[model samples]
Target: MLSFVNTTYLGFENIARKSVYTSLSKDLALKADEQNLTTLAKNAKFSKDEESSFKNTIHFTDFVSNTKISLKISDENLSNLKAKFAGNISLQEDGSYILKKEAESIASGWFADIAYKRGYLKADANNDGKLSDEERKNIYSYYGNGGFYSTSGGNVATVMATEAYSYLRAEEDFRDFTSKSLEEEFNKTLEKDSDFNGEILYGEMMSKGQMIAQAQSYIQNEGYTPPTFLEDMMDQFDQLNKKMLKDLKKLLEEKRLEQEALEKAKKELEKTAEIDIKHSNDQSLDKNLEKIENLKSQNPESQSFKQSLNLKEFSQAYMQSFKVDLKKELILETLKKQNDINYPLDMSKTKIDLKI
Candidate 1:
């Protein structure tokens, strides 16, 4: 009975070992597959075809790998792995990849590399694998300006592709068969023009018009017809000039109306001041006349009393005239006080209250 028990225990031990080995082998295979997928994703290039497919498949693969690893790994170990790879990639409930800083940086760099390669190929005018100064300038003008790409679109790849396409199209449109020769001639003509002093004191539209006219005149004097493309450019300049003139006229009209309003306000203020001065003078004159009447009643027959009354009246009038002159300064002070209170005194709206 003891021999039979030992044999049964050995058989059970063998079965347990087989099961453990099977589980270990499966885990190893999953780990290998995860590594392979990650390698494929990191090395994939940005291509016109299968781009979206590669991105989706790789991101999904990464998601699956992380999910499986998270089941067995400690949280600390997983965090260390994420930090090491600079990948804080997360999966949304909708199965979309939420790529944070590192992933975005990688994708942007890739897109920029592709765009530069494509743009350089088109912009090399002599096909010598080197860009001329003019070609470089044109490329910068179209792409270096921030407006070439729309940031409102969330897809960085699509925005970069559009920018590349536009740069190539602009190159084709602006390129002449004579290459940079015509552009050089245009610059030389502008430099020779006495009116164009290599600086634009006026607005941009006016400067552009001057440049276009100068180019046209130079072409005509040399007895050569201007290119159709150049004439189209000139027409665009003309349209811009008309729009600028309209804007300038509207601005000038607004300024003129403002000036007229200010002048009318000044005249009204002067009229109010005159009325205030006249009213003050009449009050002073009445007070002086009353004083003279009182003196006449007090000294009825002094012989020199009339002379005294006349002299007093003349003195009061002279003093009142001096006070009126000082009242101009007082009015200015009152205006300043009103301004401080942001209360404009509109005499037309309310009667003036003279407190002389």
Candidate 2:
């Protein structure tokens, strides 16, 4: 029984250890996920002025920027020329293409330009200093007649078309060179095989045909990816929402401070207004005292039994003896026109020797 109990206890211990380990692993994984989300949030946040080009039209790859795309054509395309007509390629019955001429000219232009390495080398057609008139005519005849001095137009076309086939590789002369580039990136692996002297060719590629090629190469015809993750979209949205709440709180705090400042200013203005009012009231009191002094100067003791009192004390004494208005001028006017007042004979005046 003790052995049985020991075995049961060991089993429970193993289960508890496994459970603990399982819980720890889950907790660790969850913590890692949360931490990763935080990092992603930080990186995902864009600046206010950082404009999004998501899905905005942008050129991903340009052929002029990456020209040869691999080429042996220093061509063959020109050798088939009939001189004056820089014509477009034509399609044939055998699913083939050839260059066609627009017009004919006297000289085999290719002989002067392309029969050899073309930088400074030439057949000395016209610029021969030692040649006389007759020799010059002979040189023009030999080069211009287009016999053994030159190749036929179709042969040049075939070589050029073959070269094109080598690179373009499509029968109708094209494969899709554009894609939704911003979704990923242009396949840069293809650029590893390209060969073009971009720096030197910039000034040289000024032809109208080159302009057309450039327009085709750099265009706004692709899709792009916006700032959103399909998988972690919900988490990102939640984080953004939380950020908005934080911003709202910040705005609330700012407005609260502004309101408090306005209230403080209003209180200060009220205090200033109260002080101005008090000063105005004090000025009015001084003016009234001045008026009283003027009245005293105007009135003199003429009667032998005339009574006299200070203005302040007279005002107090008159108030105690009567239930009259507060204006001193009105009380004095009433006293001056005593005939206008008809009162009881016993209550005519106070015993302070005729309170006026």
Distance from true location, Cα of 274 in model 2, Å: 0.7
Over 4 Å off, model 1: 1-228, 302-307, 310-325, 329-356
Pick the lDDT winner.
1
Candidate 1 colliding pairs: none
- TM-score to true structure, per model: 0.28, 0.22
Candidate 1 lDDT, 1-356, residue by residue in tens = 00111111112222211210010121233344565434433433322222221222113122312321101122332243345444556765754444445443332222222223223323445544334666654442222111111111221111111101112333533442112322222222222222322221222212333323332333334322323443565579999999999999999999999999976886687678767766665676566566656767887677666676466756664465335546754775666675453333343443323221
List, residue by residue over 1-356, the lDDT tens digit for candidate 2.
Answer: 00111111111122211110000111122243454333332232221222322221111111111111111111222233212234544434753334333211111121111111120111223332122333222221110000011112212110000000011111221112211111111111112112211111211213334432322232212111111322255478899999999999999999999999976875565455445544544555455455545555767553321333666665754444443223533433444465354323243432334412
Candidate 1: Cα lDDT at 130: 34
TM-score of 2: 0.22
